[model samples]
Target chain A: MTTQDTTYLDQLEAEAIHILREVAGQFEKPALLFSGGKDSITLVRLAEKAFRPGKFPFPLVHIDTGHNFPETISYRDKMIERLGEKLIVGYVQDSIDQGKVIEQTGKNASRNALQTVTLLDTIAANKFDACIGGARRDEEKARAKERIFSVRDEFGQWDPKRQRPELWNVYNGKIHKGENVRVFPISNWTELDVWNYIRREKIELPTIYFAHQRDVITRNGQLMAAADFLNIDEHDRIEHKNVRFRTVGDMTCTAAVESDAFLIDDIIEEIRSSKISERGARMDDKVSEAAMEDRKKGGYF
Target chain B: MDLLKFFTAGSVDDGKSTLIGRLLYDSESILADQLEALQQSNRKNDDGTIDLAILTDGLKAEREQGITIDVAYKYFQTDKRKFIIADTPGHIQYTRNMVTGASNSNLAIILVDARNGVVEQTIRHSFIVSLLELKHVVVCINKMDMVDYSEQTFNDIHKAYSEIATKLHLNEVTYIPVSALKGDNVVNVSGNMPWYTGKSLLDHLETIEVNEDEKSPQARMPVQWVIRPQTDELHDYRGYAGRVSSGSFHVNDKVTVLPSGVRSEISRIETFGQDQAEIHSGMSVTLHLKDNIDISRGDILVNSSHEPIVSQLIEADLCWMDTRPLDDSMMYLIQHNSKQTKCKIREILHKVNINTLDKIPADSFQLNDIGRIVIKTADPLAFDLYHENKQNGGAILIDSRTNLTVGALMFRASVE
Candidate 1:
């Protein structure tokens, strides 16, 4: 036996793998929530390390808002195919078509809030007892108060005041019928940590994460990706800009930052010295002060 | 860079949140948008200063009530190391939250109000820090500016805290005079306090050596999941997966499964589809034994030479965290690592009043009460003492009816 020094990244990875294994071990039915973003992609790599050689004990679940960047969906499909794992997608458009949720009208309308219905429906349909998410506490104020094994009621509501006390490394995953847990493997990780881990592990991400030329329109001082789903008015001016997304969400709500960070190293450096948070460009959260908390209480991942 | 996790605990008015805000602000860890939000928030102090407490009190209810309801985890990093700060609440009712925060922390910062000196909350936090067996503690005597940055006030508070520390068996205690509001002696040394000679709070935190406890030399890996690929390319692959809880396991090392006491030799160590010669503590990997033995989740794989105690009856100290008191007639689920079993509270030995550090006779425990109790389990469990190894020794009690985690238990001994 020799004394080995573990780096900060190694420790974080070890903690995440441990959590992933715990979710697999404790819950009878678990699924990894894949968003094709760097965080969830890092979760995929960690899951591979957690239970590889053998198939993942759980499948991957993705709630498609139908307003996502096509590149992200393609990346998600390719990764799932490469891993030889099952991917379950719950489409928000189906919910809207089925009258389960109503699509918002006019400007600032997005499928972001409607994703909660699709996600909850998917969880109930599949009876997933635990859903592994890539949410980090450093991302938002509401996230900072969450437990690793956050339990949701039959209605999929998160009661912030009544969270289970998580002690040591032991997470209490015990729940009755109809109750499910949201497991966050990287709750302690920050935005910089995720980018650094992606850089270290050389995990592939969507091309949109890198600086590329794309048609964008400025709204409310934010650059929104000019996608077909986005209802751009005749007065709205569209321009092609060299930009990259800090976070990937519904194209209607997600915003981009001007940058030339083409490589992972450049992105890591950008994050290390960047003034804005990863969630700063997220237009959905700008609706209210407690927007994330309100959405989380309603089962939005 | 290395990682260090610490938590801060003090009374409501002790400026715990302010100290945390100062740390983040001084380190440049607070982002521009977050700072802008803080500045724009309606909640402001009387002095027109941005209420840093709002930064940690995330929930609407907490902000409305001007209190912290649960533990809020914050992350930051310096050039030398990364830090995870569990900014726990200060209210007495939120003791469970503080316990949760302190359980995984390597160090604790117990804030002391210089004007008030050592109070009941300070003693309570100290007892919790000691009860959790944290290796390090920092007593940041804050609000020194209110006391005119006087060395005499700092010395008086230090003396009072040292007296309380003696009763709590706290050996590693560092005292620093600080004013969280004035930003004195928090991140940088204070020129005002010329008489005081010690590292500032942040400087000390950056330089402190968090030595990892020596591994027991006996490996313990609780089987978390069993993997069988059953692939066409590889016909038969049976692997037992878990994180190495303690020590290290080498390929071909003789091991024994707990309870069943099945013996086997490690045939291979696989991690991420690659075989490794050995794996150490905290590494999550799969192990394939040479011989097939009945192994399942909740079973522990230990070095054959050093086996843990397997018993049905155990005595432990439990911190009750539920509204309803512990009932002797009701059954609770005791979960240790991956193992789960039905347990009954045989007897309540004693409960300790954290403020006074006195053992009081009690039949049942209510919210935020720590008590020693004897538990009788339906089946035997493999475990080590909490002081010996935290990962293997700690357990939680889940209410069978509500399914809420009610108590945090640390095994004291196997009741004969």
Candidate 2:
């Protein structure tokens, strides 16, 4: 093989593709959790690589929070149609209406924590034994301790202290009835790695990732995108500026970073020299230092 | 960038958390607001000191006691590489937790207090690390300030650790002296000890080789899942989905499905829409067989000419992970490679005391004890010696009642 052909990226790409196939091979019923984010989008591309020219062995499921960027919604719909793959969505609004969950109310209330209810309900409803996610450990503290085939109690809660020991590349995905495993094929990939892969592969993403003019206001020291779900007071004083989201989540919770990088390469360069973490722009994590951990234990993806 | 995974084993007071906190802090990895909160929390405690360890030990009890009680993970990156650090507790009872943390790690950082020299816990941790067969080990003599930057002290600790290292089989051992509380020899080389010449902890980590065993002798791929596309575009496409456990495979390679012992030629190796010439360990790929093979999950695909031993009676090295002692008559699930079958403990040959590395005859195995056992599976299993190939030789014992993984096991030395 040529020197350039033996790169680590090539190795990682091959590994992820293998895992995507394994999920299809192992479980009785399995599905991919598509969030319309870059990580999941990369997963979609990997899925296509694993099983293309043929429908995916398993359907793609998205736990939809009614409060999402319109661009993401449009992009998600277009991708599903383009791929001609089945798209299953579980809505948080439905769960709330069904009294399965009650929306949080506060100055920074968001559907971030409530997504767990909808996600678990969807899993139980579909009887999916494995729900493949794009969650990378480098993204958060609690997620760093997760196993690739993380076993969840029948209740869908993750016990950080009691995780099964995963050695070498052997993943034990065994579980009893009513139990499920949350598999993360890209668990080893970092945010920078994700951006670099996106640039190298030229993967398409939502427009919100690139720098654009948006009406946003400063709240809790973060630039909150002005959306209908957000309770923006008259005194908040919205201003048009060039900003892009570091991450996509419940529209009310995710914040934007001021940047001028509009292209993938430029964004990669920006991330290289950037000082703050990718999740720094997300307001939801600011609820508390252990906010993500708390949400994950309660079954949040 | 190179992907590196490492584990940190040190006492709660050995400044492990602080060392990790420094890496996160100096790399500009933490958010500005999070740093602000950390500073605020430091002030809230108002102990007149910066508790950098708080950044890693993020549990309620840990925060209250100012110590790590469980294995916590942290990730950071430099321009050269990306690192995943498994910050494990140093307490003896948390030994099981340490094993969980080190199982996936490519290297281990065993921190020692320079002033205390090599303590019992240090040797215990090192022995466990060697027993786990981790390729790279870095012995960090921490708390250099406590010894007033004495090279003699650093050398003394290093010399003591070298003897301990000789007792166990280890490869690629390096030593560094640092003061985690003072942020020395962590992200930057320490100027206080100009006499010491070596790369900083991060530098050695950035350049260390990982998965060197990827090119080892045995080739194994345990089938994780099977994909069959019965659609119109691809009506008769069937592929075996799995990660290459060890070695590599290419298109047209003659392979066999284990247990079933069905021979087939690799028609194609596909990932996404692209077809690759070959695939290796750590890479996930799907294989298409030339013939119709009735294969499913829990099956292994091996080179037909280089098949593994398929046997019903075998010996295995077992690490009991359950509270309930292992019973010879009890039937448990043996998950070896990708295959799962009913099995019973035929006999307990002996148990190895992890502390002294000595074996004693025993009728049963208990929690956290390593022992040799003979087991008989209902179905023949494909396995290689654990010393020969970790991927194919190792397996987990699952309880029938709670379905909990009760033990981590390995292939035992054959008496034949």
TM-score list, all predictions: 0.98, 0.93
Whose lDDT is greatest here? 1
**lDDT assessment of candidate 2:** 0.81
Report lDDT (CA) for all predictions. Answer: 0.90, 0.81
Tally clashing residue pairs in candidate 1.
Answer: 0
Error of 2 at A285 (Å): 1.9
Residue B92 accuracy (lDDT) in model 1:
86
Candidate 2 lDDT for residue B148: 93
lDDT of 1 by residue, A106-211 (tens): 8878998899999999999999999999999999999999999999998999999889999987888888899999999999888888888888788889999999
- What does the lDDT read for residue A89 in candidate 2? 98
For model 2, the superposed segments whose C-alpha errors exceed 4 Å read A1-6, A103-109, B43-49, B232-236, B414-416
10 residues in a row with least lDDT, candidate 2 chain B: B42-51
Each candidate: fraction of true contacts kept?
A: 0.81, 0.46
Q: What lDDT tens digits, residue by residue, belong to model 2 across residues B1-416?
A: 66788999988878888889878876777866567768778423234676778778766556778877667767677778877788988887677678777776889999999889988888778877876778899999999988999999998888888888988877579999888878788888989999988998888888877766467656678887666767776678887777788887877888988889989889987765557878776666778889997998888998876788888888887778777888788899988866788998888889876666777899887777777888888888888877677778777888887677887777755333
lDDT of 2 at B138: 94
